[model samples]
Target: MKQIALDIGLTPEPTLAGFLAGRNAEAVQHVRLWAESATRSPVPSYVWGPEGTGKTHLLRAARQALQSQGRVVGWLDTDTPLRTPFDERWDAVLLDDVHRYGPEHQHMAFNWFVNAVSPLHGKPRAVLAAGRLPPADLPVRDDLRTRLGWGHVFELHPLAEGDMRAVLRQSADARGVFLSDEVMGFVLGRFSRDLGSLMQLLDKLDRYALQTQRAITIPLIKSMLENE
Candidate 1:
């Protein structure tokens, strides 16, 4: 059975520790609850949001956490089909962009969800899924739609208003980089404003600043920008 390759551009390291769950705090906590051993297996959970809203990040985070605990976790992305005889050996399964599944696929997925949440083979085999719309708004099969909403459903809210800068400053501070307002503004102005890219730039600048024994000043950032 062939499966579609995962998106090459998805973030490489998406651990629970690394996720910057800003306005998605409550949702984040809900998802992480599945990782605890005593919390019960096959914990069917759903997280929904528009693209680039950390849905992929949180799904991968759960995968990493469960894998560390020695659970067999399966992850299927947007184009990947839910290949059947749906393996019950899996302790956790993460389905991303689930709204894309068509009628037949949805039926297969519905069955998988049913068994996962049921105590058929003891504690349920946990599942975490993400999509571009909430279960109620999803344009998939109604029965499948109802099942999706059965568990703890969370909406992955985008970062809070006006907090990105503070997040950058705090991240920089933690990494021992003095990201000045001027430089942060300049970087924000001149480069990609996405939180992920901005944070990566700040990290690289911190390393460069340490290597050159230079303060994180505008001039230093300017030089770094040139090399970048």
Candidate 2:
């Protein structure tokens, strides 16, 4: 039988403030600043990095920031074909995971990049795109790959171990749970290390603790993991 999974929790917003930028602080600041201003320079940004380096988070945050100011923004991703080209009508555009895009998606994204910087547009527009490889190495058409370098291009680095721990601790505290040092250490050693997945794991642990009426301890976590 096919399993039916229900999404029972509220989806959290991905914002610049919530991200632990770590070594990618410069990239995060640049994207945030560009999104917050409509009259800023017409520099299109391209950010590329490993799969879990918070690329999608930055893209979503940028789009949300622009929309909050009543500026029209366009967002696209690899999961679907483009319905409309991101054009001069938008104050900014955020295109996520370009590496997963086939040829047609690149056509839309490339046009956006070109026109967002065209002198004929007469208005400031920013285009933000992200992929898993740098511009020169991205497996897209040569013309689109070349356009990705027109503005600020950042290659994000993974977070440090210390930053990961702090993220877990902060998230646990915010959830009204005491994340003990020993338990935290156990989690680090036994579970996924990426910050995004780590946060999700902590959320699961918090809910599990509540369900079982137990503190989130190493033994409790071990028991929970064993059932998986």
Q: What do the candidate models score in CA lDDT, each in turn?
A: 0.72, 0.77
Give the Å error, residue 106, model 1.
3.0
> Distance (Å) between predicted and true CA of 80, model 1?
2.4
Candidate 2 wrong stretches, greater than 4 Å: 1-10, 82-89, 119-124, 173-178, 203-215
Clashing pairs in 1: 41-124, 42-124, 42-125, 42-126, 43-126
Error of 2 at 38 (Å): 3.9
What does candidate 1's lDDT look like per residue over 152-205, in tens digits? 888876665356677677666666557777877787778776555665676667
Give the TM-score comparing model 1 with the true structure, all chains together: 0.67
- Which candidate achieves the best lDDT against the true structure? 2
* Runs with alpha carbons beyond 4 Å of true place in candidate 1: 1-12, 41-43, 81-85, 103-108, 119-122, 166-228
TM-score of structure candidate 2: 0.80
List the candidates' TM-scores in order.
0.67, 0.80
